[model samples]
Target: MVGMEADGKMGVHLDVSTPGYAGRLEVVEGPTGRRVRSASEKARIAAESLMPGAQVSAIARKHGATRWQIYDWRLRLRLGELVLPESQEPLFAPLLVEEAPLPRVTPKPPKSAPAKVEIAINGMVIRTTVEVEQLAQVIRAVRASR
Candidate 1:
């Protein structure tokens, strides 16, 4: 036996050709009716269960499962591969759309006229009002700072 005490639940058998009873761990169909958890999911769940203070192995023992199985489920959960139990009817009255406050829309300021800055480069149309002397001073300051 690969597990502990035998639980009489009808589990999906991983070994199709082999017939036997499983105890703590059961090979069961997943939400998609697939035979097993995807390999990545298995690894992910294993990693989560291994996280500090996560009672993964104990949970497995209590649920008649393996730590690996819980870990696989955790991985699947992360990837959103597992399907939640569906209910067509809402258990409670859903809040009406109108009851919720509409999002506040911030009005954007109107665009202003573009500012002009002039450059000394040939063929360049500079719109800046800085005098030539000021430009020279700024350039010297910039170079000095650098």
Candidate 2:
């Protein structure tokens, strides 16, 4: 007979008087299985699993979950389906801004003296550092004067 006992335990009573049946079968009630984790909890566990040198198996065992569950949660996090609470999220240190050092200014070498050339035209000598084109014009003017 399958029925609830007076002690609040559900049990099965077998007919021990029957041939070849000598033991009574009792069914004890236990806790309901399959815990439901919240999204924040999943996110927290997933984040912990992602930490440096963190072992997924250890984290999952600690949280009464499987490594696959943590992996799924991580996938959900990457897909934006899981959102970690602000307090549980990683924090970054504020950046410090400072003026960069001025670049070194090296002194330039002194400029070399311009080249000088002498030209003797119509027995009159000319020496200057003027450009070739300007010197040609001056020579032309001198020839035209004669």
Candidate 3:
């Protein structure tokens, strides 16, 4: 059997029975070997770290892992490298689809008619519709006479 103490040290208790021999108790130091965590176990641990008020240090200790390892697993899960187990399927809101209302089309008002201009050149009065082509000529004549 294997057991871990409060100080975070793991030790194994070995009992051997023989024809005429007494069992011996020996305490080994350090870890016997490296432990490989399965994918599902890693997912569970990573998810546990995300729970409300969950402490990374506590989780790491409970699972014999480091805080950085848990953080890395979370990053991998976000990047899609790790996926949740079958029992922990992802939940999502239903997608809603509806045709958007047609954009409003407002007809522009008719442009206002140009104003009728009256110009007095010296004592002579010139009354004519202000045409773009003749306005320049009228202005030139008035300036030359002045």
TM of each candidate vs. truth: 0.25, 0.46, 0.39
**What is the Cα-based lDDT of residue 118 in candidate 1?**
50
Best of the two (1, 3) by lDDT: 3
Rank by TM-score, descending? 2, 3, 1
Q: Please state the error at residue 97 of candidate 3 in Å.
A: 20
Task: Give the winner by lDDT.
Answer: 2
User: Candidate 1: global Cα-lDDT?
Assistant: 0.56
Look at candidate 3 and give me any clashing residue pairs.
none
Evaluation by TM-score, superior candidate among 1 and 3: 3
Give lDDT tens digits, candidate 3, residues 1-146: 23322333455433434343455679899877667888778878888888778899999999999999999988887887777888876443467999999999896555555446677866787776665555678788878888
Local distance difference test, candidate 2: 0.77
The full ranking of all candidates by lDDT, starting with the best, is 2, 3, 1
Compared with the true structure, all predictions reach lDDT values of: 0.56, 0.77, 0.74
Q: For every candidate structure, what is the RMSD over all alpha carbons to the true structure, in angstroms? A: 19.0, 13.6, 13.3
Query: In model 1, how large is the Cα lDDT of residue 146?
Result: 41
